[model samples]
Target: MTIKQHQSPHTIGRNFRLIAGILALAACAKPANATDVFRFEGFGAISRGMGGVATAYDTGLSGMMTNPATLSLMETGSEIQLGFDFVSTDIEVKNKATGEHVSSDSHGNNRHPYFAPQIAYGRQIGSLTLGAGVFAQGGLGTEYGRDSFLSRASGNLDTELGNSSRLLVLNIPLAASYKVSESLTLGAGVDATWQGLNLDLLLGADQVGSLMGAGRVSGSLVPVLGGLPDLRGAHFSLTRNSPIKSGVSAWGHTARVGMTYAFSEDTRVGVAYTAKSRVADMEGRATLTAIDGVAGQIALPGDITIRDFQMPAVLNLGLSQRVSDKLDVAVDVSRVYWSDVMKDIKVGFVSDSGGDINILLPQDYRDQTVLAVGAAYRASDKWTLRGGFRIAQQALRGSTLFAVVPAVPKKHVSLGAGYAFSERASLDFAWSHAFEEQMDNEGTPNTSAPIRVNHSQDNVTLVYSYRF
Candidate 1:
């Protein structure tokens, strides 16, 4: 005889709820208006206020997420930090021919005041330090309604062509640092990363025809449907408009290594390198619909996959100097290798009706160089003030497909302050403002209408720390 056991209905329901809650939390982790293209300019309040200059300075446990070597500079005890970033974006798109424009801030339904949380813990043991933390790397997104000029330009003047895109990246890192000598320290970390993407796009008939003529669109469905002469007025769309949905997600891994050396009691230098992420293909399900003057409308539900999308590697170098007993200054320079990963975006759609299609979107992004400088003044034993400025090179070589995801800001000004409430607790706050930038794209073979985008943003960070 054999005996078998099955889970009760109550247990199964409880498990289902738990899984759903986790997925919901992940889906709602949205980020916007990152300063370094789609990547944030800094990690924590102190770094943000100091022009992202954590490479050589001690900014609490948050340094573990950037230059791990700085962790060795913390006091020999246990520390916990909690923080969050609040971001606000202002973006507008215009059709030069139609003289019509749409603002990302005008849509009431558009989610604003985005928030991302950070938490970290570190412990110092003799000459070594260990730490762990969760942080949001950065992301870009925008929303426009059906009545917007973008919808009218797509030839769907009356339909709900909500053009949008949202991308979010999160990291959980385990790091360790060791003090090699009185003036030298080295560190490394391994990061587990998660990325999510959501998109809603509509392409006009002219663009669709150009993609076909250029051989950029292909698949099993091409032979069966491509030959139709009535396709002249056809349009294509991949749409999912809900803000609470992740649409597609993937997991990846990366690593970072860094070192710091003190030249004297008043001067120090640091260097760090972060490897590119190796993420899996983003996979999900969505509706792929086509509208034609002759065929009327055809909708195919399918699974979608975004292939070969990865983050770029970065190198950072920095120096810090103690000019006086109450004044300190720091500077950092970084190189971002964006050209390696931003060549082309390939989208694969496998329709439930039995055919698969592939679409190619070219980005042609260039590498970027960033420089930052900051100063901090100690007004008293309980008060400190900080100010900084940062400048970055333009990352995109062209603006063809950037109208929807405009990461164009190139300069920022920041201010911050820190207060010590007690020996064991403290508070830090920072604010950064990105200057407005505008870019114009010439008419391409796919469409004759020139497009212009204007973008700017503001970011605020607050952190609370407790040491034991």
Candidate 2:
């Protein structure tokens, strides 16, 4: 046999891998949010539908960062996929005073129906596979009406009163996997991460004083809190609008490495480590609006900046097993180093009269562990069904949870399905819902009285793929 004839198949695979690499890199860009404070369990429709079980299982390019070694399982040809997710989130805050109990009315808030997009491609050659993708990894945000009960309690009568936040990370991962043996593969990737943030806040002076502590505030704030005869029992309302007034964005880079081992034809396990993306400070526009029943109104022009903002590293492990020809199951566990990057949220503002003001909101967040399990069933050559469950430990508690980000839910249920339209094309769909969870802090030093926040979410994802 001639060498050219023997190498024909390998040559074709190499060409396919090169074409896939070019397409994947050319399509890399931004998209938009998922899990934790703004972290997602999975990146594509198949994985999300399977309760984020991509770490060990082969789910096309979506598993690159989760476990790049999964790429070695791909077919010799090239494949491309695009996915979109629609997310809805809800947040509620309740305040308790001596005689008054008020809950935030955020029904039909209309801030949700968020859209996130993702794309990826992969190809296999002789013993190597290469790929790249753009994924919207994580984000958090909430919206409330101006006439909500919380707004009224905060003393907003002339204008709207609400607090909202948007944190998004776009990751571009360039990855390669090498098949060391028939059952073992190793892979690694470099990630270029882009992060964006927008914060709109309205806090009562009492709440601010509690969070900032008395020592951090100037003596002038004491008189406004009720020392003056005309200002007794009077409160100041602080307003910060950053999304529209002033926007904040930053870019950083990180990397991940992983390995996958196949114990048998029906079982496999994978592990991976992702480094933190160190980003710059986020600066935006802010205004402090204080409404005093006795002194009328006070507005201060300032800028809001949060320093040393970063995303923490993660360690992930996964296992996948095929119980039968028709049934497959997978599980994943992850440890998130939140305390490394979220120890404190420092808010600094510079005003025309007050000069420079700095407030340190202590997060002291604890590390979190996430668990996920999923099952997929192949009923027929053209039809597949999937179901999954996921849960994560809370990173913060008590007053700190309510004072900072309070929308991290603890549990989720997911369902998904796939249909093959042709020999080379398929459609996938997934739906996941987070159960409502709440945390309450009663008379904590970080909060004057009692404060509680409730949160939940619903997500739908769809993707289309073609292989050649």
Please report the candidate that would top lDDT against the real structure.
1
TM-score of 2: 0.81
Tens-digit lDDT string for candidate 2 (81-182)? 777666665556676553334332222222233455678888888899998988887876554445543444233343354544556677899999999998
Q: lDDT, candidate 2, residue 50?
A: 83
Q: What TM-score against the true fold does each predicted structure earn?
A: 0.89, 0.81
Which lDDT value does model 1 have at 81?
Answer: 80
Give the distance in Å from residue 146's predicted Cα in candidate 1 to where it truly belongs.
Answer: 1.8
Off by over 4 Å in 2: 1-33, 97-113, 152-160, 212-246, 290-295, 352-354, 443-449
Top-TM-score structure, candidate number: 1
lDDT of 1 by residue, 1-468 (tens): 011334456744564465345334433333366889888888888889988778898878888777899999898899988777767788888888878888775242234334667889999999999999998888877777557656542344334556666777888889999999989999999999998777766666566666778777899976655655444332333433444447788999989999999999889999989899999998898777665555645677889999988888999998999999999999999999989988777789888889988877767888999998988888877788999999999987544555667899989999999876545556788999999998887655323357788888888887877676
lDDT, model 2, position 72: 92
